[model samples]
Target: MSGSHVRLEPLTMDHAAGLLEAGADPGIWAWLSSRQPVELGEAEAIVKAALTDPDRRAWAQIDLASGRFAGTTSYYQIVAKHRILSIGHTWIGAGFQRTALNTEAKFLLLRNAFESWGAQRVAWETDARNLRSQRAIERLGALREGLLRAHRIRPDGTSRDTVLYSMTDAEWPGARARLLARLG
Candidate 1:
């Protein structure tokens, strides 16, 4: 649950307010398909629902040095029997981006799923136009599995292509090691 620079913890009701506060900027969700929370109450409600889901996995990123709420992430296409999961719903506050907070958060999640839960693979998907996210996933050593054109509608009420990336158990150890090295 904890990583070197950040802690990937279960998203609880308590983090609702912090998430809203960190997400106050509407522009933050520009690239994400989800609706931006207009207020704290809305943020709380959405996070509350995500936490209680039986299969959909959600996690909050915590900054180790300051212990502040960094952002949130989740696994949606959960296939427990196949030991496969997908990491999505990811968005780090502007202050947290490009800061290695994301790398550390993912390293912990990948480590947990593959190491702790014996998962065969973990996945990541993003808007195909989101070049930044695409690169970030590649840096973690996730192979470019493929692209789902016209994947889904965005919050702006338009469609977007989805880029899929993944890391298998065999690749996680080395990927994890590289991520850790970047932290130093």
Candidate 2:
């Protein structure tokens, strides 16, 4: 998926170095499931896991201005027969945060899921404590459904509550328009 500010390409081992560099800021990994990758080997391991995951379709977000890997995102927990999927596992480099890159990347992914895949619903979940992520999802026009308490264990070994959001096919048109307007 290509956008003015960012392009989404299938992630590969070749992106490990760029991923490591872009992910140099420790703050970016705070809300993420994995620890920060400190070396090329660790970044490669991260890439390999994404590629090998059976239920995930991962992509490397390439910043158009610099033509470098900015971060990664994925479509996971896909259920083809039900036409449902969740978008998460996203992290943008510190430099790319608060830029048009995230909006365009999400717009492309949501478009593909709803239009191309004929999906009935697209869902998102984030750590309940991550207000920034919650706000970002709301800005994308996803309706907050409810919260799941103790949904998962954090990397620090603490129970994490998850905030859930969703956009159905019925809601896609409005959401799409909103996203486009933001991109403009």
Best by lDDT: 2
List model 2 lDDT by residue over 1-184, tens digit each.
8989999999989999999999999999999988999989999999999999999999999999999889999999999999999999999999999999999999999999999999999999999999999999999999999999999999989999999999999999999998999899
Tens-place lDDT per residue, model 1, 1-184, is 8866888888898998889877877767888766788888889877977887787889989988889998998878889889999988889987888898888888778888888889998898888888988999999999999999888989788888899898999998898888878978
The model with the greatest TM-score is 2
Once superposed on the true structure, which residue ranges of model 1 sit more than 4 Å away at CA?
A: none
The superposed Cα distance between candidate 1 and the true structure at residue 133, in angstroms, equals 0.5
TM-scores for all candidates: the values are 0.93, 0.99
Model 1: ten consecutive residues of lowest lDDT: 25-34
lDDT (C-alpha, whole model) for all candidates: 0.86, 0.96
Query: What would the C-alpha RMSD of candidate 1 be, to one decimal place?
Result: 1.4
Scored by lDDT, model 1 comes in at 0.86
